[model samples]
Target: MPSSRHLIGELESANLLGRGGAAFPVGRKWRAVAERASGRAVVLANGAEGEPLSLKDRTLMATRPHLVIDGALLAAEAVGAPDIIIYVGAKHRAAEAAIRGALAERSNQLRSRVRMMSAPDGYVAGEESAAVHFINAGDARPTTTPPRPFERGVDGRPTLVQNVESLAMAAQIARGIDANTGLVTVSGAVRKPGLQEIDLGWTFSDVAAAAGGLARPVQAVLLGGYFGAWAPVDEVWALPIAAPSLRARGFTLGCGVVHALSEDACGVDATARIMAYLASQSARQCGPCLFGLHAIGECVRRLAARSPQASDLDRLSRWSGQLAGRGACKHPDGAAGLLGSALSVFADDFAAHQQRRCLRRSTSHPASLQPVAAVA
Candidate 1:
């Protein structure tokens, strides 16, 4: 068994970052829990991928359950945590079965310490705070931060909520291997839409090729998920997909989602639909998240339908600024990020939509806009 200090050193050398959207350093998070946890801590493997465009977590859970479990156990040992919980979305039947079968293979002591739980099928259900709150109380809504999960979570004990993909990488790091590749889910207008293990430094075109190339001529790409930013196809095709590289360009490889839009798709219409879906997923706890998202969604819809007033765009810009950082959670901020990027990245498309002259009849069916209850 590796000491907590040794494990942190190994992770730091491997440069293993969290595969979650935040891209936080995994080693630092582990060290924080190790030092701050006063008593028995909780290790939670978060496989409840609330991002609709992302399937990598479910794929990892179902296909590589052992790796995820190994990582969780390693984390448990590192933090001196006795309890481990694998949280999956309620509808993820295959992943649940895989995890349960894997858990059955462990020793009685290990099995006794590990368990599984079903997460609510909502976008915010996968948020770290929301997951901690759900495990502590019955509600899955996010709470205000200050005493973060690592500080106080799960019955007032420090908790470590890690993404499943991050755990899989940690499993590799435990075996003296450095973190190199990551799981990516490439979908939408692709010839072969599926999950692929990609090298960290690979370019966007490399990712596209792993999915057998684009099924149609590409117009733009949503680099992350619904809460992520968009980039023109030409601008990002050759760009490296690594977090640092993308972050330098003011973007992230958020949840390893790469959704491509076909040349014939209407960006304005797609953005409007996605914004509306995000609005519906709000917890309704904060005024900015509930009311502000609704207002922005409506405005985007009107713009998509070419029925917006002259000042609609200006109002959207202003409201996005107002809604950001004002909510208890980052729900409002994520919506604002999506809307702001759409306005900037697809300026021509939005302008055309406002003039009732869409470039192409939209053939895009963004998975991000699908009803959460309908996904499995």
Candidate 2:
């Protein structure tokens, strides 16, 4: 039998929001699927977060798959969907096993209802619409919106897709956890770089402390992921991690990613590296995302290679805005957000570069921006 609708009713009253990068209200998404015509609907836990620097989704699935699956089950019941799909990244073997094991341990009623599928290893493949396409024998690139997942999804049925962390949060809400916190995997220069559950009202300082603080004096902090906010370390310490508050600061919660940059770290170089990675991850379906992200990455590369001209900076900012909302998915918007934040956070470096000076470390290669795991 389906879990009690009364339990789902309790979840609805908690005002839970998706902990995914998009942060949609979970109850609203439930309503969308629930009210669809009497045909079948589906629920997906997107554990395919392929961004190498961000590990929150994988961590959730690996360590707490039951929470994710229970949440998925609740979502499926709420929407009257007979099937549940837990989509995991190809490389997330640990996560895949956790989901399988958790399902195996469940009653036959639950075990028979859910299917775990692996997706191609690409960053954009985890996007909701893209996941629907991949599941339907189409390529893993995102399609044009308005025929969005909620309206027409997997096999032409309504689908409610959410990130693993978001589903886990829903489970917490279903269980009536008050002031439910979400997980952020803090990495990079922090002394501890692991998944930490923090209340929404907590400041960046609290997260940093949870991650064992910085390894050295910090120059800046990157919130979210590759497509995230770049703030002076001091300034970010004042900002809370909640979606609404962070959005008011023009930031996306971005799948619970928090990266700290050390004093010796070059924000300009780090930004360039991440941009290059994002460019490489493009599924190449839309012309704008395919061309625009590579172009942005190329510009960042040139700036890091030699002193960039003031014109170079202006050109980057201009292109950044042009690419903001022009793609089939949020890829362009993510790229623009990262670029804009880099421009704002690396102002001093941009100035120095424009004046014909380099600001990179003498002994280290630029790739040190790769994150490290947090110790307990």
Candidate 3:
């Protein structure tokens, strides 16, 4: 596609927001890079949505690679970048192929302008800073940031690093029209497990309906990815998917993967499994992360072993806040986010466990939602 300012205008008009789980404004991020004096800039499309329960990124790269690449190119043009990078998990071969195919079919100029880098598949590895570190010869782990990617990135140059869905939304915005919302991959206990693009401000019920409704009566909803919130189905019923609303509710419209569990699923056991996965995914660079995650995991294991004691619950609560902002990365914070929400929404469950009488006992669902390995 020819370079054009109209593309930027289109994004601004469409309100084509970023869908990178964070839901940051693409227009604002573009302006940040556009104002930089570094002269050299780059765009990185982060397709490593490491949420094991979510397939939105892989689906997008598999079926709509051109749109994402087009968005990346548009971002590059807006920021005056001559180069663009598509960072994907190594294991997503289908997505890699789709991106390759999309690039091959494009003009030689477009093809030559973009580079695809497959990152090691790990949860923390997909964070923008981590991806940047990996691209710059460091390990695929997040580095402490005062110089965030927008300020200094990709060999100390200004960069726009966004999720694959964010870039794809930008591409759609480049088409000069507003999309109602964006795509989401809703799995777990849903009648249909797939990706669907819906209008903004839709409720959880709307998303669930699009997915062909629940396979069984819903017990609770895990909105976002691994480190997201858990709410009773009732609380999530009219819940809007927009970041603002979700945040207001003490939740986030994260990676757009809502895992609705049935009444048969034990919340405590589920929490244990997820915590175990988070602990394992740590890059093991920071003390708080390495030890805190293990400690938290051990705590969950205790809870699962029998229900946590009232004292145990109190201890978990205290540690949740302690670890919230102490880590080098957001791993602890995200873990805290998920755990805190679990504590709040599943208060009864925690209490029941404390009494050694959980409402549900089934552990049929896997212990973890982490992909077997990082996708790279």
Candidate 4:
């Protein structure tokens, strides 16, 4: 195995970014834990894929469990940590079984330091603080920051929480392989909706082509997950899917979710339903997330149902500004961002819905909005 300094140096050189949506630098994260450790640090392999549109992590674990295990082991060795935790999603039974079965094949020394736990079902359960909190307290909800996972985690020790794909990439990098490829979860309107392995050079268009093309003429795409916003088809059709590059361009490749909206679908209606889902998944640790998100979700829900009050749209814009930076985690901010995006990408639809109309090209009754699926 490479030394801690050597491996971390390589990670930095390769610019390995987290695949868990944050796009945080992998080396910096491991270094923070390594520096804070007295051989007491912990490595957490995050397979708690709570994003409804994302299945890359669980699929990776089920099909390539050994790679994930190797990455976890590498993370532990590189960070001078004796303990490794495979924090997989509770709903991902096949992944859990695969990970456990793979661990059984490892040497006693390697297996002894590793343990597996089922993360609770919900989106917030995938947050870094939430993962640590769950391991230490049996509750899978995000906690307030300051003593972040790096500063303190799991039994009050520094921890490195990494996405499973990022770790798989790490393992590949360790073997002198280039980690230039990524996995994207393509859902909604694609003929074959599932995982698409993409090169760093691939664009959103390529992703679409790989998924067997769109089933219909898409109006827009819900890039990232529910926390992300809708991008008009023209705006993102040719956009690069590279996480870091996308972030630089004011876009987020969150959790590798790329959901296409069919031409016949209502963007406003989809956004509204997604908002409701996100609000329901709140950690409920703070008022902004608990109450404010509910309020925003309710407003969108009413708008989707074509019964918005005179002030619903105005309140959405206002509440987005009001709720940002006031939550325990970034949950409220994410919700606000999504709402903001919806208001922009679906402006026409919002206005039409206000007048009991739908802009869908295939609408049977143009004056009445139809029930649309929410990125299903």
The prediction achieving the highest TM-score against the true structure is 1
Per-residue lDDT of 198-286 in model 3, one digit per residue for the tens? 87779989999998988877788888878788888998789887777888877776787777877787888888888889999988988
User: Which residue runs of candidate 2 sit more than 4 Å off their true CA positions?
Assistant: 1-9, 37-39, 307-310, 360-368, 373-376
Query: Residue 90, candidate 2: how far off, in angstroms?
Result: 0.9
lDDT of 4 by residue, 210-243 (tens): 9998887888888788878788889878877887
lDDT of 1 by residue, 1-376 (tens): 4665698778877878899888999988998898887548899899988888888888788888999999998888888788998999887888899999989877574732898999999999999889989988988989999888998888888999899989889878888776989988887778787788999889999999999999889888887889898888898999999998999888888898888888878888889888998999999999888999999999989988888988787788788677789888888888888888888888888777667678776635553233222223
Please give me the total number of clashing residue pairs in predicted model 3: 7
Score candidate 2 by TM-score against the native: 0.92
Worst 10 residues of 4 by lDDT: 367-376
Candidate closer to the true structure by lDDT (higher is better), 3 or 4 = 4
Ranking by lDDT: 1, 4, 3, 2
lDDT agreement with native, every candidate: 0.85, 0.78, 0.79, 0.84
Which digits, one per residue and each the tens of the lDDT, describe model 2 over residues 166-267? 777777766667636888878777777777888888998888888887677777778888878787877668888888888887776678888887777677
User: Which candidate, 2 or 4, would have the higher lDDT against the true structure?
Assistant: 4
The deviation in Å at residue 352 for candidate 3 is 2.3
TM-score (all chains, Cα) for each model = 0.95, 0.92, 0.92, 0.94
Q: For candidate 3, give the lDDT.
A: 0.79
- Candidate 4 lDDT for residue 192: 74
